[model samples]
Target: MKSAFAAALAGAALVLAGPALAADPTGLWQTSTRSGQVEITKCGPDLCGRLVSSEGLKADPALKDVNNANPRLRDRALKGLTILTGFSGGPDAWTGGSIYNAEDGKTYSGTLTLDGTDTLKVKGCVIVPLCKTQTWTRLR
Candidate 1:
């Protein structure tokens, strides 16, 4: 009877600890400026983030040559881009992923870390390779 009780307790403990061990970043997270939000979901063994909401800009902008020198910058779309991928660092953080900056039409390879229940630290850079991090709050 005691052995059976111990086994049941062990099973209960495992059940309680299971979800904590697994990394589930699925949620709606807001940007620092509250200018936009991204929905992060599990994509196979990896994770992918998509733009879900925007404040100051339209959903889709027209591809025009307002700034004639940069054609690629003018034609870039801010929505529906896979901003994060190949997360293989650990349970709480993601490393070796790319972040797309639609404002400049540039993609930077960087790392992401979960700071709290509603905060994500994202850092990306260009020339120096030293990332400047920003805390993104979870919206929902």
Candidate 2:
């Protein structure tokens, strides 16, 4: 009976720890610049990241046109669109993903890696690839 009880407890522990081991990057994160915060969440089978809040953002003088008429800026979307998508690799890392830069309204193919419990590195680029990398710190 004691052995059965021990086995049941072990099973329960595993069940409780499964989600943590899954390594889903769904949480609030602070931008590398320490200027804003973004919320990364799972969208259906993929992942989507968005700006949850920010500081030092001008209300009158717009920093940049996110959705410009220029073809080069077509992939970029307003803060409303999911910036991170098409993630199919794994919970700890994602490939074949795209990140939308709202500041410039440019979309670039990218990859994401969960650096720590609350840190993520998102890198995207144009010519060199893996040119622009930002370390996002998780927020409570």
lDDT of each: 0.69, 0.72
Candidate 1: clashing pairs of residues: none
Put down candidate 2 lDDT per residue, 1-140, tens digits, no spaces. 99999999999999988757657778888888637677788788877787655553434232334455476655443444466777667767888888776666677888888876777888887756447899988785
Runs of candidate 2 with Cα error greater than 4 angstroms are: 1-22, 56-79, 127-130
Error in Å for residue 89 of model 2 = 1.3
lDDT of 2 at 92: 79
Cα RMSD to the true fold for all candidates = 4.2, 4.0
- Per-residue lDDT, model 1, residue 128, is 47
TM-score of each: 0.70, 0.72
Q: Over 4 Å off in model 1, which ranges?
A: 1-23, 58-77, 127-129
